[model samples]
Target: MATADPSNSSSAFAQLTNILLAKGGYESDEAWKFVEDLFKNIDGKVLSSSSSVYKSVADGEMVVGLSYEDPCVTLEKDGAPVNVVYPSEGTVYLPANAGIIKNAKHMDNAKKFIDYLQSQDCQDNLGLTTTNRPVLKDVQIGDIMKPISEIKTLKEDSEYVIAHKDDIVDHYKEIYTSISSEK
Candidate 1:
């Protein structure tokens, strides 16, 4: 297991929730409620950084049951062999999506921009630099992202969970207030 500092409340809870939502397909509002409930049950303060969480865990500063991701974790970073867990409970997978704005003045340019982004060269660059899983079938990006074989993708026919965008944002605002009041 990777390590994190429990006292480092900078990014722990938020990053955990973000990753969980990405894997669980929770709508933003549902995600907010889930996180709120999660924090309400935990004793420690939530930090904003995973690095802090990792350190805290590593140093035995805190204990939590969660998983994390970092593309840079490799033998070079002295990272231990850890498998990315896919809970039987379920997860959400957010593919890198791109689209042109309907009313943009540079419609043609926007199309070209999207095309460029999806090109093999750009995909390779993104794979090399980030955790982005390329959608293009032809792009042979290796070493930069988890191999396609290793990924546990959501079923193509799975039902989508849509969150009320406005409600999600507003709920998070209240959750933040609740968190602050507890301090």
Candidate 2:
């Protein structure tokens, strides 16, 4: 299995943590224990970036990866043999939000940008040109990208994630370091 190094990609690391916690029914306190056992038991590869994880899988260097969905969809659309699985235990979907800041220097431009961002034309472009799952329900996505409604999403506990994020990063680093040293 492959994963992004925690220090290099905290967002990817957070996603992986969400998967591990949900999949094994492990609490925040026991995250370290579970992560340690995972790396120790599995043939794990910690890459520098999320892209590296996908590249490893694509090159057949790794059988599976705890990576993002966008690249997988992109790869599949390009005819690469890849199976994107949303863990049955549940996985979090990262939502992108856009808003204009208060007292902006260019209020008119900001409004225009926000309007353009919300427009169906832009949303459709996001869905078609990129692997981004469009927020607009009416926008059609690429053939390989699964609709958000089709995914079994995990109800994120924002407070818990925010509170434990630092601890998760620290423990992951320690565990990864220890495992790397042992090898």
Candidate 3:
């Protein structure tokens, strides 16, 4: 997971939490209420998102975000395995792609950068350091990160990126503005 910048808009945090909860079968209103309640009196910014929340919860912090309610129930009691579950609700998948501009002067440099990024050494480093999934077929991620083979459900029915890119961007911008105004 990326290190969240404290300066980032709260709306980004809110939207991230909202998406996770909605996907995890929690009602949107209820999820927002939970967020509000969780951070009601806190002064320092709390990490708010499924990934960060899961990490925080795993580390024994009072974090709240989307997950299988059962996972939370178990973690709150049994305290074993410690996995974060994304519920099988309305999950939206966002697949990323890399492309170059139609007319680029630094085409060679771009290709070199992409080639370097796809190298085995780079992939291995990325796997150990961040949430980046290796795109190269031959790159072995080893035990540092969760293997793609282990994530059967995600492979089976991953959501494609939003079809209406412009609309989605506009909607998120509006949401960010609305939430930031309250801060």
TM-score of each: 0.48, 0.82, 0.42
lDDT of 2 by residue, 1-183 (tens): 887876679657667567656765336545557677777766455777989888888888988887888788788778787788887767787667999899999999999999999899999988988987887877977777777777777766667767877776776777777888887
> What are the runs in model 1 whose C-alpha is more than 4 Å off?
1-91, 142-144, 155-160, 164-183
Name the regions of candidate 3 deviating beyond 4 angstroms: 1-64, 67-82, 86-93, 155-161, 164-183
Tens digits of per-residue lDDT for model 3, 117-174: 7778887776565545666655665343445554433321222222433443454345
Q: Local distance difference test, per candidate? A: 0.51, 0.76, 0.46
Pairs with backbone N, CA or C atoms under 3 Å apart (clashes), candidate 3: none
The better candidate by lDDT, 2 or 3, is: 2
Alpha-carbon lDDT of model 1 = 0.51
lDDT of 2 at 98: 94
lDDT of 1 by residue, 1-183 (tens): 332222343233234434445544345455556666766665335545565545555445655435344532332134533334444544334455889888999998999999999888998776676555566765665463456555544342222212343343455556656876887
Q: How many Å off is the CA of 91 in candidate 3?
A: 7.8
- Residue 18 displacement (Å), model 3: 12
Residue 112 lDDT (model 3) = 89
Give the lowest summed-lDDT range of ten residues in model 2: 23-32
